[model samples]
Target: MSRHRQRQRERGQAAVEYAGVIALLLFVALAAIQLGVAAYAAQQAGTAARAGARAASMPDGDGQAGLAADAAVSSWLTPKTQSGSCGDQITVSVTIDIPQVLPIFDFGSARRSVTMPCD
Candidate 1:
């Protein structure tokens, strides 16, 4: 009877341990996913900024250059947050919104700046 009771107790112990391991695995997976998203967003922002700066570097009126830069960045970044300047040298700043996976925590926004000489 005593041995049987011990075996029954051990059965539930395995289940508890398994649940803990599974929970830990899930936490790690979520963290990895968040990191991947952040890296992707940052890369997109950098690409967008570079494209915008290149466009703005063209030899033309500042208004046209600005418009071109805005259009170039719009494909990858939100229009409301995209900013840049055009002159002897062109500079572009891009900010991208980070997707929210958790309600109580925020990963914040990703920003990138790029500069290029006018052609």
Candidate 2:
């Protein structure tokens, strides 16, 4: 009877240890996923900047920098854009709010800029 009780107590301790390990692994996986989301947001911002600048540089097209930028990225990662002319060149800047995987990690936003000569 004494040996059986000791074995049961050890099994309970082992179960608790496994639960703690699984929780830790889950947190690490979540952090990795959040980092990937940040990288994707940065890449999207760059794409939006290039597309907007290309559109802005067209001599025959009406200026629609915002429209081009919005079409270049995911719908959830909508980009805010600003365009200006410096001499013969046009520059477009794009900013996007990074998606949150965990509420505690609000890493703000990503931004990118591109310049292209006017056609």
Candidate 3:
């Protein structure tokens, strides 16, 4: 009787341990997802900045260059403005929206800036 009671008590212990392991795995998975999203956003920002700088360097006009840059960037980005002297150098800036998964956590805007000489 004593041995049987001990075995019964130990039966639920496995379930409790399994639950803890499962919870830990879930937390790790969430962290990996968050990191991936952040890296993707950062890559997008860099691409947008480079595109914007190249556009601004064109000799034609700022309007077309800005538009082209915006198109090159990810849809999450809203092209702000391209400014600088005509013959000297031009600067292009793009603002990207960061998606928030957690209610308590807020990822701020991602911005990229690039400077290129006018062509």
Candidate 4:
């Protein structure tokens, strides 16, 4: 009877350890997914900035660089874009909110800028 009781206690201890390991692995997986989302947001910001700058630099292009930037990115990103001229160059900047996988954390925004010479 004592041997059987000892085995039952060991089984309970093993179950608790397994639970802890599974929880840790779950947290790591969620963090990895959040990181991927942040990276994708940053890449989108860069792409939008470059596209806006390129459009603004063209001689015949209409002054819709801001609109171009917004259109270049996914709708869910909600890119806030601005364009300005510095000397003979046009600069475009894009800011986008990074999507949060976990609601309790704020991952902040991803921003990017690009400059191109005016034509």
Candidate 5:
């Protein structure tokens, strides 16, 4: 009876260990997902800057730079675009907030700049 009771007491040990490991695994997965979101946000910023610069470089694209940048970014992200100097070169800068998948850390924002020759 004593040996049977000891065996019964240890029966759930594996489950307890697994429970601890599962928590760690979940944290790691969340971190990886957060990193991926950050990368995507940075890519989106670059795309927005490029599109805006291309628009600003054109003869008829002076006022359409903002629209082109807004259209290039993903709907889920809001972009802040700044354009300057369209004489010899057109420069556009785009900033986007990175999504926070994990509440433990603040990922802040991503920024990109592009310059294109005026056409």
Candidate 6:
């Protein structure tokens, strides 16, 4: 009887250890997903900035550069873009808000700048 009771007590030990490891694994997975989201947002910002810069660099693109940049990114993401020209070079800057999977936390904005010679 004594040996049987000792084996029964050990049964719960595996469950406890599994619970601890599972919690850690969940946290790591969530963190990795959040990182992927941030990287995607950054890439989108860079694409939008380059698109805007290319548009503004054209002879007739100044009037529609903002539209071109907005169309290049995800519809859910709101991007703020600015264009500036100095001599023959044009610069476009884009800032996009990173969407949060966890509502209580903010990952902030991803910003990108691109410059090209005016055509």
What are the per-residue Cα lDDT tens digits for candidate 6 across 5-119? Answer: 9998798898899999999998888778888988999999999998999988888877555787899999988889988764598888999989887665588999999989987
Candidate 1 lDDT tens digits, 26-105: 87788778788778777777776776666667765344533554565435445223444555676677777876555544
lDDT of 4 by residue, 52-71 (tens): 88888888655767778888
The parts of candidate 6 lying over 4 Å away from their true place are 85-87, 103-106
Taking all chains together, each candidate's TM-score versus the true structure is 0.74, 0.90, 0.76, 0.84, 0.91, 0.81
lDDT of 5: 0.92
Off by over 4 Å in 4: 60-62, 85-87
Q: Which ten residues in a row have the lowest lDDT in candidate 1?
A: 74-83
In terms of TM-score, the best-performing candidate is 5
Query: What's the candidate order when arranged by decreasing TM-score?
Result: 5, 2, 4, 6, 3, 1
Task: Estimate candidate 6's alpha-carbon lDDT, on a 0 to 1 scale.
Answer: 0.87
- lDDT (C-alpha) at residue 17 in model 3: 94
Worst lDDT window (10 residues) for model 6?
A: 59-68
- Which pairs, if any, clash in model 5? none
TM-score, structure 6 vs. true: 0.81
Q: State the local distance difference test value for candidate 3.
A: 0.70
Q: In model 4, what lDDT does residue 6 have?
A: 83
* Top model number, lDDT: 5
Off by over 4 Å in 2: none
